[model samples]
Target: MTDAVSYPEPLAHPEKRGIELIESSERHGRARDLFPVWAAPNVSVLNFTVGATLILLGMELWQAFLVIIAGSLPWILTGIVATSGPAAGTSGSVITRAIYGIRGNRVVVAFFGWFISAVFLALNWLASSFMGAELLAQIGFTDPVLVPVLVTIIVAAITVLVAVFGHSLILRSYPVVASVLLAIFLLVTAFVLPHVQWGYTAPAPLEGLPLWSAMTIGFAILASSPLSYSNSPDLARYLPTSTKPSHIIAATALGGALPAIFFTSVGALLATGIDSAAMDLGIESALLALLPAWLGPIFVVGVIINTIALNGMTTYTASMAFQSIGVPIRRIPSAVVVGAIGTALTIYLVMSTSLLDAVNLMLQLLVLISGPTMTVFATDVILRRNRYSGDDLFDEQPGSRFWYSGGWHVPGLLAIGLGAAVASLFLTSSVWTGPIAAAMGFLDLSVPVSMVVTAGVYIALTRLAAKRRPTAIPSIEGAPA
Candidate 1:
């Protein structure tokens, strides 16, 4: 018989919330509060560039916007996961053990966690470092290499400090960040829109890539929206348990998708208004040259703020993920460890000549890995109807329901590997494309294909696992008493 869990009121202390199942009483926020957290981070230069790149590659404004809207559709799935947080009362990674077993779940969380945080963190660092170097040059520091190194060190230090303060503070700051960024971008958008040729098309000579290929790139960019689901639970875990799952789902989905659409559409408009060659100089340079003198520096400041905010959240989520890996450290220490390692990587990439190529490679790699992993997790959650024991997530004793197969769920492992393998066969990116993708005229079908394949394989394997071990008690919530 299971002992009843005693959920005291949610603690207000910053240190009290790390890596533990938040008790019922501890949950404090409402569903509507999620909007800023999901919206704020995406209102950045990185997303703008996602739109600009498609136009640079040969897509028309309408085409680019359509592709972006389509790619963002996956966030619907992410919002669904957000709802699981309050009910489960823990980090989503912890709740995953019900599907993959305690030990098996680690593999998924560690890979997805490290990659998602590291890639985005590096991108954020790169953007801020470049701008910082440019600002330094204006003020008389001219060494090409030294300036970037200094900027990276400074930006990474600030980001680490923000992350170390932990969750509640992070939540409080998102709305402020969102408001400032929204105001800045709205002004820029107002200035740029009148100059935009509403019906503009890609120029002849096609910019060296066909329109279809550009659409594929655009799709990959939008897919990053859904891939963000990996960290949404970190925010959602604080909401009141009575917050309806439907409300959680709606808030996260709408909040995230709206900003992404707005910014990306602005990028599409800006892409058509400028000399296409400006695309080669990068989004920041192009925008700086086009905007009036006063507006230019303000744009840079906005990007810097966005960079720090995005990286700060990445660092925080990564620390929680580390703790979920069974590490004995507290949340702040884990944040420090991941922050240092991520900072080192950011500095290296910022200082390197191959920075753009490296960033593209990292994004493609995420597209490859995230699809199957997300599919398996989503399938598990849906099949179980999101029911989870708040107590079981942390229990590791021998008889714990989550300890299946000595902590490894073979079927789950097999499904993920097989699904990712099949998806890689059709992936297209700057770094690599699968043979099948190349054969199919280099169309990127990685995300959809991986989801379908993983879903099918996981469903079949899970059913088989059940039949093969008829007497084995299932670990899912609401299993037979």
Candidate 2:
């Protein structure tokens, strides 16, 4: 009998995996596998809550759906980024060193990677705890204090456990998570769709921002979708080298956008179908009032499961982001650190009087950071035509092409700063309302302003550099020594 070759599980060597380039022999799995595995389960309490706020703010049903579509359109960039994984053979933040140089990438890894992940972990944990507590109460565990504590323990534990195991288990769990959540959401949709006030066109509550501000909020929501692309390569990096770019782009974009739209639309329908007070009670309460009693418990379980799925990914990605920041630790240990920090933040957020206010603030800040970076990175990818030297990517030796001015890509860094400043001028949020936004009647033009300014400056500077030193710009196919 012939001896069989042995292969280890993807997450088997967690410590061995941080930010390193994957060898061709080590890469496996289809690009298409990511569609159901990551996409469907991503629709969680956050998406529903974001959608609910639109209705609560008096956006008409059609308007809400249109905005969701508009916001979701940015998910395409995430899918595009996913295609970079196999060739780059590293996590998203690490891969950006090609554009920004290794030292320069630190700025992005801090803001886009570690910070965004930490904030999201806390946000997801808080939302999950809220839903889990209410679910427990409905099931007769009505001790207010005990329920919240138990929920926190259970949710936090699952997230940490899954993250520590790393990639294989996370991908495997998505199919199950997606199926269960989809079934439950479909049932909720069936219950709510019939009762939706399709013709309701009334203005939102006065406390809500006026029309211009609402539009800004809508764009901010849209920005979050694309911002996710920042770390998408972390998940996509496991695919085989031959995986087609088109396949990765299509799978991720379709997978993520579909469920997001479905759930957000469902929330919109529910928001208009019932009084806003029920929504204020929580997404579960809104569903429980409409869903049959028996279905309510099952749906709540689905909500808990969905929440876990989202947090699990957040914890895993956050760990990768931490590792990308030159942390001298294994992935599992880093994940433990993330879990501890995230848990503490979550506890603080849960005790706060207004979770919605916190969420709005986080989203606003996210747009200001993500919008400029995306413009610069996307432009870099287009300029290079996706051809990159794998060796040069990780090389930080003295003469490495990526070592622009002792590892700092000054132009790229400057563009990010300029973009953030322009974005802040029009930022309208619970965090800090910009003077320009107030003067412009709350126009909220932050995203566009950031994109235009950052792209304009970066492109201009890059072309100028290219003209001055033709040898400085390296093409992906191969570079002259």
Candidate 3:
């Protein structure tokens, strides 16, 4: 047998590979190493914002906790999907060729994957810019217009710098980042917890359909956080094939879910101490008001760092998605492009919209697409038993195994279409409420509806297709179970 390709190790260098298969020789790392990789990004002020938003939605403290746990469970699906990384030896964007066909996969990657990543990149930059601008104002650099503009540029530059350095640098840096963010957040928790009203509830608690609607909305908002990580395999693809699927699942799931749950719960607690009027000012301002003045700068710094950690991971996967979509660009340039576009979006949103309102609407709408897409991906992984041929997956010729039905896997496309269509009818948001949701007292069933329909339809269609054409389903023998 010929020797496997050698690649550079973790160092201060830009990652050279994009959607290309990682050679076995180049795959090195314990599956557990993924914990920090997933965790650090999620140790975010956004989670805190989410928690506060849940309280604002009229959920009692206990109800919010239930929503947080239930909503975050989707990370388990994300973890299951991560196992495909070691099995396929390629990023998630590339692996979808087996499910959607080479040509069809491009459309999904370009729109569903890359577009969502870019939106998230912009959101993270915007959040961090606000915090960075606050830090400047505290230090007497308080020109409202110029401060935000300058801060956004600085935040974008820092985030792009980390992403441009690529995979090895990200893996090496995230553990330290996770450690620092966790420590600082814990300190914030200590300061905020003493003031929490343990038995707090809305003075006029929601009843019946209103309560259910509130719960469903909260669930959709929280679940959207994990569902958006459908591209998680981009980070896990470099692990050795011998790595246990269980370990990868455990590490990735817990790494993300733990910090998310904790920080969100903290937000819930912090919200209990603030009046609705203070909360209307924004979660960041309310949170800072609760902390000692000395900790303000430190808290702002933590928020900026958290944003960098999250956006760095986002931009990395987005660059891979860019290359996967047949973009004739290298990884480094793709990073720059994604960064530039994200920066532009951030600037526009800052100037025109209420950041919190934009965030809420985006999260609600995001679940309509992200839920079905992730469900389809996770379902495909299970059907194949996590077995894929990295070399065969890259074949894009007309008669190649992945080129089913003239470069489209009809079942996958049809499933996603039917799923998203049905889900949209159940969507509930300030911007638009679907017909079904309106009739049902505005209950948001979009998240669960999309996932169930996508999985069920994809499975049924894939089986029927297999009966007609045996080669329609590619099989690889001796793959690790």
Candidate 4:
């Protein structure tokens, strides 16, 4: 009952390959017919889990948390734009298309989005199934390994089901779920905050310059809240007209930023007692340590929702990532693949080992990549242009570009490269924590430093690149399928 979708490839020109240059039609039809009424609920839980979990982990060590916040600020700030905006999109991918331009390459956008989706999907699957298994184990009603594995399987199936049954169900659920998540987080924070030693020097405080171990820890923790930068449009696409665009900042700051302060405060407090294995203990375990065993499990049951809440969004985003590239597996099929691979990795890969090394590599890669991508998106939306009036969002045509230029936007590319390079030097390593390196040599938030480096370098390069010849936005004639 589904039609196979083969995406049209981008042009064969070699220079243009710098961008992915691909467009796709609605290969997979509606995944679900659920109404849009659930948006608030879904967004509520989604933001709470994403925001708190990221801060709880990444900010456990203040300096490390600080480092991550420094580098990731520009992008995370966009959540305000993403959530505060009005409903301008007919489809999620269309937003990406608008920026990519009908004449400009968009496959570049899809490629990065896909990579981000894969990471989110895998992490969320692990977190959710862990929640389900732990809750059951707390009640002594299930076997350990069996329950964990079974729940993972079921979760994966559900993801596939949602993906297959897509549409209003997932989108509408955002606001509703996000509201619940926000409420719970607030309650949890209220309970946990009293325990934190505010301004307490983080254990083994960033030595001299921040330590590599701490920097790495910070880097990993910072990653916990990546969805705001990565998955906003999916949620953004579902924003109601009744909501003013500016309210997004309020929603994001409340739903996203406040949770960070709450989570980090909790993690920091817990670290005071369980400093040695803080990273491994999991935030929920640390809280459980503070309460009675019986209460621990009850609290953990809520924590367990991290995996479910996040993974649901992850699988959903992954399907969109797939569709962006013209992989038209119906909702069910896409969900199945994302869930199976993601959950399987959780049970088999994450359970047996620490993904510390993998996490570092991934964070490093994404930071630089996302920097430019974020710049283009924010720049386009906030500064340069508004809605596309020229071309069908799906059609690849010369609809919008700054100064009406054609071909690749070299300034964006330069900015990303510059940002990543600067960010990397500040990264925790044998030589130094990224910020300390930049700061002891230069002292302040590493993000501001990196932004300066990226912006200056990019501007210089853009001007330089522009001197040779006027380049038009590259023709992604086949961009919108």
Candidate 5:
């Protein structure tokens, strides 16, 4: 019946097909506004919640005002401010296009993004759920465990809804929420100021524990530095490239820093009044106590709002990772699925493990994955000897750096995995064999060490891999636009 069997040109190369679809994704909401995407700030509440662990850290290791100020301040400022979300709407692909080559190797970017996201989804769910539920109990909510689950469900729903509407809404909405958060932080810190024991703990121990032990207990738990992490760039993709990147960075930094300062004050205040603050009063309850009776509902609303703000990011990033992986699920569908997955896992965490461990693990991985992903982009765009700039947005040549070896990059993959693995063994292995000694200690190096390893390995591997393989593939039309 067929005069001659022949397949369409695009059908011959599935990689090329993959490229075309992803390129179309770059074009969503072309007519939408850019300000919303670039300006919508992420306000992380971990500044306060993280105090639960840091309170414990202060008691166990060192609570040096200087060190806490140093470690926590920049993280608070840079994390929230330096970070922005990915693109959405008309200009969404524009930022990504700028980061990757114009030849459109987003697939390569997506691969790494997926790995990073899978881990982050697990962290966000567990951290927010445990923190939310515990906070409810602090306010005397009945059956604290059950209360966290319900709150988690509500939170996941709100984030999914916001994300479904798109980043424009997220951007416009965040500023309002952030304003309220600021007032709350300021008021609470002022209330607690009278209690700071400058006379008693004035020169808080700059060196309390052994170096290794301090690293194990202190930095491991302290890594959630909400200032640096909360306002990730997943939503910022909507800003017009014409919008200066530096401006976006500065705004987020300022927004995120405020929370860090407030949270650190709360932690130090809690420590200062150690004689008075009950074990149960720990962190969340302490803040609740600082508020007037009239403000209880407002405080609860604050917790709920913060949960929504960050979890929205979790769901959004999780969906992008899934979409990039070519899941049959659409963005909305993927958001719901990932949200449920995070919530369910969090429920398991609340029931079984120490919530603090879960918090540490998540923060560690966040630092680890983020470093490599950021480095790859900066290197690919800024450092590559061969440039692929411009509206080369639709270009998706096969065997390109992104499409090489069937779209699996062993170099980046190996670097990331190795970094995570090595950090786990050296930094956290409970059975300490020897110390080379006391380098990182028997603690988690998810952030500091991972950054070191990721940067070192990615560059080294890329250089080695580049020598044998040609930098660019043949500029053929058979695959990708």
Candidate 6:
């Protein structure tokens, strides 16, 4: 396999490579480096918003805490999937070619990978802009119209610049970013804890079926944050193949899950003291109202910085997704394109819709696809025993091992399709409600249901295909015959 062309210092030049394989010569970094890479993004005010939404969804303080912990647990699967990066020395988008075949994988990457990631980029930008605009207003630039537009542009520019700088810069910068955000959030947490009503409950607490339904929806909301990160391999792909898989998994999972749980729990606690009217304005407004005036500007700055860190990874992954989908663009231009699209979406959401409502709907919808997609990825990694050839994965010829059944892997495509279809049946969103969810007293089982169905179907069909035509099975590099 040819080595990826080395570039100059990442800080001085934009990343030139896209989804190309990273050869062993170019691979560097310990598994533990992934901790900050993953953590910096999860240390977000958006996570706090998600936690607050759980309370707004009628979950009690204790129930919201449980949901936060349980929901963030999917970061474990994200960690497992990251193992493929070192094994394959490629982004998650390219690694999936082994599971879905080259052509089939393109379709999956274009829709589930790129489109969803782009939408999230917009959401992150919007969240930061909201906080930023508020900060400007506090400091006397309170033009309702101009402040948002100005903040959105500034935030998008910073985020895209980081993404264009690419992997090395991200690795070098995120630890510092994570440290600053962690300290700020810890301080915020200290102020928040005292205000939490230890025995807080909803105004009119839900009963039996209603309670279960609310909890399920809250779980889906919480789970959506972690599941959106199916691209964990995008960052881990630069780690040496000799890196321990357990270390990779632990670092990535703990890095992401720890902050997510802490920040989200803080949001839930902060919600206990906020009035519904303040919440209606948004989490930023509610949070600022509780914090001392002196800390308000600092919190706002933290939110904006957090958005940049989180969106940097999102944009990087989206650029890789574009390349994985066969876009004839360089990584730098792809980052620009992703940024433009996300900025446009952010402007629209800010001008035309309620941010919280849009966020809730988006998170719920995200679970429908990400759940199954990540499940398939994790399952494939286990079945292959974490062995892959970077060269073979890049091959697109008709006879390449990854080009199954005329460039399609029926088992994988079917697994994801059936899984998403099943998940939709248990979905509860403003967009649509599944009949199964309605029949079961409106319980939303989308997350777990989709994952289980996808894994089961994929295992069954892949085994059947292997038995019928063993040669068609994935080329496991070091497996026992």
Q: lDDT of each model, Cα atoms only?
A: 0.74, 0.72, 0.85, 0.46, 0.47, 0.85
lDDT of 5 by residue, 189-276 (tens): 6766676565543333424334335444445445434322422445444444344445555555445444555565466555565454
Pairing residues by index, what is the TM-score of model 2?
0.90
At residue 5, give the lDDT of candidate 3.
Answer: 32
The digit string of per-residue lDDT tens for model 1 on 1-481 reads: 1232233322344443466777666668788888888888878776766777677767777778789889888888788777778878777778777767788888888886687777788877887777667666766998877887787778778777777766666678889999999999888888888768887876663443455666776686578557656667777887887788888888888888889888988887888888857656566667666678788778778877887788888887788887787777777778788777877787788767433455556666687677777777777767666766777778876657677788877767777788889888878886778998888778788878888888888877777666645323232332321
Ranking by lDDT: 3, 6, 1, 2, 5, 4
How big is the positional error of residue 313 in model 6, measured in Å on the Cα after superposition?
1.0
What residue runs in model 3 are displaced by over 4 Å at the alpha carbon?
A: 1-5, 8-10, 474-481
Model 2: ten consecutive residues of lowest lDDT: 1-10
Give the CA lDDT, 0 to 100, for residue 411 in model 6. Answer: 90
Which ten contiguous residues of candidate 6 have the minimum total lDDT? 472-481
- Tell me the number of clashing residue pairs for each predicted model: 3, 3, 0, 53, 22, 0
| lDDT for predicted candidate 5 compared with the true structure | 0.47
Is 2 or 3 the stronger prediction by TM-score? 3
Could you give me the TM-score of model 6 versus the true structure? 0.96
Rank candidates, TM-score, best first.
3, 6, 1, 2, 5, 4
Model 3: per-residue Cα lDDT over 207-236, one tens digit each = 899999999999999999899898789889
Per-prediction TM-score to the true structure, in the order listed? 0.91, 0.90, 0.96, 0.66, 0.71, 0.96
Q: Kindly list the per-residue Cα lDDT of model 4 for residues 330-388, writing each as its tens digit.
A: 44455567676677666774456333333434444455455555555554444322333
**Tens-digit lDDT string for candidate 6 (1-481):** 2236674345888887788877678888899999998888888888778888888888888888888889988999999999999888788999899889999999999888876777788788888778878878877998876788778889999999999888878999999999998998888888888878888979988779988898899889888877778889988988888999999999999999999898888888888888888788887777777789888888878888888888988898888787776777777888898899889888888887666777888989988888989999998888878877777888889988778889999999999999999999999888989999989989999999999999999988888777645654632342321
> By TM-score, how accurate is candidate 1?
0.91
Instruction: Name the lDDT value of residue 382 in candidate 6.
Output: 85
